[model samples]
Target: MNRTLIITGKGKVSATPDIVYIRFPILVNDVHYATAVKGLDGIVASLRNCITTNGINKNELKTSDFRVNTQTKWNDNTKEYEFSKFEAHHDLLLQLPFDTELINNTTNDIVKLERNIEFQISFGVKDSTIYKQLLIENAISDAKKSAAIIAHASDIKLKEILNINYSFSEITFRSDLNYSYDSCLMETNEKIMPDLNPDAIDVNESITITWRIEN
Candidate 1:
């Protein structure tokens, strides 16, 4: 009978993000759908112009999501929900390199456009191909090393790998500072700057290897 040795390995890789993503919300409300959409268009045009002045191409502004919904409100006389208006939202985004000067300049320009406007900033890597490759390599190496050690201790020989499986854990990144409109509108006397440091983003992966051993 052939015996098998199964070993699992864990790998973690860390890297600083090379890119920045900012999400801007453009909201409009009106009694008619067409009017609501028209209001959104006006805001979109203004946002495009704002980013273009900061050396960003107008095309770089992407629409993450756009949708219209009917809202309701309560009336004092009826004491029941009534139709409020149509609300349209355009979630716009911008991708920029991790440059301090560019970030400072671009965000400053965006804040001046409107006081109630809300935005979010997140740091991320441009390409995760290299990190993924490295993670797999490390996992494989770790499995081999562990299997070899166990086999040697047991006085057994490992001949061939019979199976290899990788877990489905997704790779994701997190941001340190996420700005909202209300918090951003604080008095200028008490100022807070967003963290510029590109914190280390960790990529973790695991693999299991089964090796056939001499009986």
Candidate 2:
């Protein structure tokens, strides 16, 4: 039988996020289907204008999902679900470079749309491939050093790399903020800046390597 040794190496890379992802959800409810959809369209138009004013390109704002569903309410008197209204949901996603001022400005403007807009903000890096490569480098170096130390201590020689295996894991830096204003429009002249500061995102990777040993 061939003698072999296996080692699992782990690595992590942490850095400040360079990109910001904003998700806007617009929900409109009306008894009439057509009215609900029309309301959604008008609300979307207002939303587009608000973000564009903050220097965000119209093209960057993409619709992730749009659907209309019939909502029903349970009635105790009828002992059955009653037709309530049609609900229209529009989910939009936008990616932009990380900027505290931009986040503050856009959110403040969204409130002025006079519609209840529930939005979320998250952080990410633009170049994921670069980060992954650096992560792999670190993992491989760690594995080699570990193998060398084991070989020296055991008085065994590492002949060759028998096998190398690596797998990718999602490196998510979710500083997601889910917030919404009351149905009432924000009526104020002074800007209400939120206290927002995100910590560095840590991306981790791991790999396993097998080395043939000679004794």
Task: Give the worst 10-residue stretch by lDDT in candidate 2.
Answer: 176-185
Q: Which candidate has the top score in TM-score?
A: 2
* Per-residue accuracy of model 1 over 112-174 as CA lDDT, tens digit each: 665345677888888877888888899889889998899989999999999999974677655
In the range 123-214, model 2's lDDT, one tens digit per residue, is 78787777677888899999999999999999999988989999675766554443344434456443545676678778778889999999
Collision pairs in model 1 = none
Q: Once superposed on the true structure, which residue ranges of model 1 sit more than 4 Å away at CA?
A: 74-80, 167-170, 173-184, 187-195
Residue 54 CA error for candidate 1 (Å)? 0.9
What is the lDDT of every predicted structure here? 0.81, 0.81
Off by over 4 Å in 2: 170-190
Candidate 1, run of 10 with poorest lDDT: 183-192
